[model samples]
Target: MKVICILCDEAFTPSKFQARKIMKHPHKIQICETCHDRITTKVNMQRTAKP
Candidate 1:
């Protein structure tokens, strides 16, 4: 199934299993792996930043 990333708006097709997982959370925002990874990296960096 096709889904657009809520963060970057990039459109792509997810595997059947992924589609089912996303659908299971009807109210959760959907973000592509790229955005997810980027956000995670940024957050981790901030957490480890010098004060």
Candidate 2:
């Protein structure tokens, strides 16, 4: 499946670190290679539950 970053609010390939270490969760967490080591969704866990 294609992944959307849960940090920078943008589309990107997810990080292997967040994908595996964060359990089997496909949401709530995100990672991207082109995000400058940053997440792509630009979402805040304290507010949104999207990924």
Candidate 3:
């Protein structure tokens, strides 16, 4: 299937194995190269802040 990397902002075609790899990650991830970094960085920063 064709999935864009949400972090690198680069489109890609991931095989079944690759898709499985991404899905196995702990973080909440969605295939979208156009906005992966934005989502990850924003979420991480929010999560790391002192409550």
Best by TM-score: 1
Q: Model 3 — TM-score against the truth?
A: 0.36
lDDT of 1 by residue, 1-51 (tens): 778899899997777877898789767677888898999999999999958
Tens digit per residue, CA lDDT, model 3, 1-51: 566565566678766776887678737555664375677899999999959
Candidate 1 Cα outliers beyond 4 Å, as residue runs: 15-17
What is the per-residue lDDT of model 2 for residues 2-40, given as tens digits with 9 covering 90 to 100? 566555677764466655755576445554566643333
lDDT of 1 at 9: 91
The lDDT of each candidate is 0.85, 0.55, 0.68
**Candidate 3 wrong stretches, greater than 4 Å:** 1-31
Local lDDT at 46 for model 3: 93
After the best TM-score superposition of candidate 2, give how far the Cα of residue 10 lies from its true spot, in angstroms. 1.2
